[model samples]
Target: MLQIEKKKCFVELGKFLNQFSLEENSKNETVLHNDLFFDSFVDLIHLSQSHNGWFTPEQVYHSVQSWAKALQEENLNQWLSNYDFSKVQPKTVGLILAGNIPLVGFHDFLSVLISGHKVLVKTSSNDQHLIKFLAQYLIAVNSEIENFITFTDGKLENFDAVIATGSNNTARYFEFYFKDKPSIIRKNRNSVAVLTGEERREDLVQLGEDIFRYFGLGCRNVSKLFVPKDYDFQPFFQAIYEYKDVIFYEKYSNNYDYNKAVFLMSNFKLLDNEFLTLKEDTSYASPISSVFYEFYENIEDLRKQLENDAEQIQCVVSKNAIPKSIPFGKTQQPELWDYADNVDTLEFLLQI
Candidate 1:
């Protein structure tokens, strides 16, 4: 398929996805293949949590909604305009996706096909269904797109380049295994927020969205916070009260209970609001149901610290305390150009 054809296919898929939301599922008769896909897609959204406990309907729909907005013609054109595809030579690219969040690897899939490369995907068992369902929808939109995509249960092979997301330990194995091929190997990276203590309740409430979305499993989720030395927890806790309902989910509730117990037994200090716990720690990667925080003496010094640790950080959320910080609660809602690991996937694919 031509590049324009591929873009059009995704745009159509986006429209199909736009109909689904946690609030309701409304079918648009104008969307192609709705007669074949609309109802089944809604069933899939409802079934996602049963398949993967963390893939709650709200989270899945949020991801779906994000992509629906992302694949608009204008967004696609704006994103692709930066790269020249005239010199591109098509190649088969293998993708080993991480299923941390719902459709977490879809962006990589989209990047491969949108860049005019054949994709060999090994879907993480945790996220096996959703991406495949979308791929099927894309094929239904244009049968030619079928030639550009493949999913395998065995192993990835015969691909010129690779893009893999995994933990730091697995990254070591991936680096050794794909040493001969051009690759983008992603390791564990966490996002953090720099709190200035002047944030409005609304700003912090939105920040709660960043923290609680996807049950705090995504790399873009704000798992850590940087606060001033004398920062008080009263305002922060009160601001995040809106998300207290998150504790009602069994999986999340269980995690809160377990992690809190571990922290208590270890004699670590904690600020608790029943649903979430705030721990003072220097680590960027926090466990589920909790966010790690550390005090900073100076904003300038903290900016220097974060920049030096950029590899371990995915995004820095702040109003303006740190440089290039993502606004209060926008960490999870990344633009098309916001590449994971800050590594340009399209650039890697096009080079292959």
Candidate 2:
């Protein structure tokens, strides 16, 4: 299929996704294949939590909306405009997806297909259904696309290149296993926020979205904070109070209770706000229901430290406190070009 055909298929997929939201889902008859897909997708969203306890309706809807916005013509054109597709040759690209958040690996799947390549996908068992459902929708939109997508339950084979996301341990295994194939093997990474004590209440509230979204499972979630020495925690707590209801979820509440007890038993000092805990730690990766914070005396020195540990970080959120840092709450709303681990996926696919 031509690149334009693939693009049109995804554009239609985006329109289908735009119909669903956390507040309500309204069907749009004009969308291609809506009669078959719209109602089924709604049922799938409702059933997502049963498949994976962390896939709440609200979280899944947020991811759907994010993708809907991303697949618009303007966004798609602008992202693809940067690349030259003339030299592209079709190859079967194997994708080993990560199920940390809803549809987390959709970008890779989209990248390979949109670049005029066949995709052999190994959907994480935790996220087996959603992407497969979308693949069916895409094929329905354009039958030509059917030949381009495949999913496997067993070991991946017959693919010329590969993209895999996993923890640090699995990444080591992937590096050795896929040693002969051209690949992008992603490991663990976490996001951090740098606070300068001048943030408005709204900014801090947005930061809460970065921390609490996906229940802090996504790599883009702000798991650490770098604040000035003697930074006041009261206002930050107040801003994040809006998300206090997250504690009502049974799973999150269980994590909160268990982690809090573990900390208390260890005699560790914690800043608690009834729902979330803030601890003083130098680590970037924090546990669910908590964020680790550290004191930084100078911005330059902290920048140097973050640069030194670049591979461990995914994104840095701040109000221009660090170079190229993302704004508060926008970590989860990454653009098409915001490749994970700063690796250019399109470039990799094109070259392969």
Candidate 3:
């Protein structure tokens, strides 16, 4: 009965969001315009800025709507059909939210809520507002959410299952404490891009948005690039230089200065402009100083390199052919179906 109710509720929520997406003050429009609505949202985030990271309100709204659509009834049903929930029922689920990116915990939150389990959330101080706002909104939508969710500022205990997201060090702590329980302990990760010689200048510019938006703070942001050995770096750099205004922000400036100092100390080479620092790393998620670019001589070698680094990457963006399972972000926006930490959250929900 609970499962049936959740499915109906989600379907209704999804429909409402579809309508919400059409409003004049829709989330995307506000982001694209960088207008008054965006300013208000930025203010809300500023409240949480004492820590390292805070989300723009546009990021919060888009993520919520996306989760509603991705975890819709039919998808949930398909995932649940193969599992037995009788054993996982009424579990107390604990979730640790990551503040490195906005709405990083939404998928886990949806999983616990739709599973009909009680949720205990430990929110990152940097991102407490959106969850608090949504908690209120959920109650408005179906008041009964109050019965299933609770926010905590301290330690939680006796939870049957845990889904925690944090740095690699923090994940170790969670593993030690919850190893005996059913858990998904997520470690730090970032995404990457594999560029073939065929990428057009327009696509490269949009790809810069993937790298520069949010000041390169999110897990979805591409920190590393894989390019064909013969591909020239100047054109790629030129395409992204148009967004140089993005680097003018004080926060980004600080990172750039700090990284630039470190680069000078280390005697590393880089080509910099107003917005980005371009360096080379064979890894994912570059620092504020620059993104890492590596050149591969052949497609087969590139594929081999990507396969080796698959465990470290959350997603891979490419203009060339990509696997069906890998998702693509349209411009700087992510659809609801993109799961963070590479977890299939809706599938986890149905089993509980």
* Candidate 2 lDDT (Cα, 0 to 1): 0.96
Instruction: Give the per-residue lDDT digits (tens) of candidate 2, residues 1-352.
Output: 8999999999999999999999999888888988888889999999999999999999999999999999998999999999999988899999999999999999999999999999999999899999999999999999989999999999999999999999999999999999999999999999999999999999999999999999999999999999999999999999999998999999999999999999999999999998999999988888899899999999999999999999999999999999999999999999999999999999999899
C-alpha lDDT of candidate 3 relative to the true structure: 0.67
Ranking, lDDT, top scorer first: 2, 1, 3
Full-model lDDT for every candidate: 0.93, 0.96, 0.67
Candidate 1: residue 208 Cα off by (Å): 0.3
Model 2 per-residue lDDT at 52 = 98
Poorest stretch of ten by lDDT in candidate 3? 29-38
Candidate 2 residues lying further than 4 Å off, grouped into runs, are: none
lDDT (C-alpha) at residue 324 in model 2: 99
lDDT score at residue 14, model 2, on the 0-100 scale: 93
Give candidate 3's error at residue 92 in angstroms.
Answer: 1.3
Between which residue pairs do clashes occur in model 3?
A: 66-336, 223-285, 223-286, 277-290, 281-292
What TM-score does prediction 3 earn? 0.82
Lowest summed lDDT across 10 adjacent residues in model 2 is found at: 27-36
